[model samples]
Target: MTQGPIRLDIAVGYATPRKGLPSAVSFRRWATAALAGRIREADLAIRLVGSKEGRALNRHYRGKDYATNVLSFPADLPEGLPPGVRMPLLGDLVICAPVVAREAREQGKSLNAHYAHLTVHGALHLLGWDHEDSREADAMEQLEREILAGLGLDDPYALPGD
Candidate 1:
């Protein structure tokens, strides 16, 4: 892990009503936790969106016609940056507020905790983490659990009655 405080530049936007969503500060905190041991510094954006916008983005990008919880779009930097240079531009995250709310309710989880988990998950994705296979999924989930635990949250992948 890199030493020193992580320099983070985060922009949070709301395309949906912000009445029940997490604050920008909270999102930044979650992202910071996710990147704590993984990255030294980064720039990213988190956009809270309604179902319609979320669905359209999912459809257009992933070809899925539903609004998923969170979508990560990593930064596509230029091909040739000189040596010894680092890009702080990590990527962007799109969170479906409604979907997240519904999932929290269905999973019997605290709303804030769920948001924190998703924010961490999205940030990990921005750092090139993925769950395309069973092994990768397990590793990523373990990391997420550790991050969330650091934030005083329960294991997000635990079963309801476990």
Candidate 2:
């Protein structure tokens, strides 16, 4: 399915001249477009921060001590047919750049590929996809696999292949 362009509201907490990823806005836009589903006009905030802040948010929200790849917080909107024209406002997708980079290296993948996967994964969450159970986990993984494959990335589940 072809997706239209989107406007991203990005906030970088730890910007540097010589460190971190480049062209993040473009990266996010591509990922969003790659996973376009029910989300219309999204209010996305991709915060690129250090490990400390990442860990704090993870522990407070997800009960995880260390930083994770991505976190999605979807806004609770009324679930009914709406009158007039109101685009759905998908909530935030926060990604810890350092953690993503580390995971990419450890997983033997490129930073771009990892970013794409996390971005797609977080977007899926914003569209209400969770992995708490076997059925949900399988469905989410299938979607992730399809999205990553569309971006020409390898399967995130399969072991690092030749």
TM-score attained by model 2: 0.77
User: lDDT (CA) for every model shown?
Assistant: 0.91, 0.70
**What is residue 75's positional error in candidate 2, in angstroms?**
1.8
Q: Residue 118: error of model 1 in Å? A: 0.6
- Candidate 1 positional error at 46, Å: 0.3
Give the C-alpha miss distance for residue 112 in model 2, angstroms: 0.9
Number of clashes recorded per candidate: 0, 0
lDDT of 2 at 40: 39
Query: Which stretches of model 2 miss by more than 4 angstroms?
Result: 1-18, 77-87
Tell me each candidate's TM-score. Answer: 0.92, 0.77
Which residue pairs overlap in candidate 2's backbone? none
lDDT value for model 1: 0.91
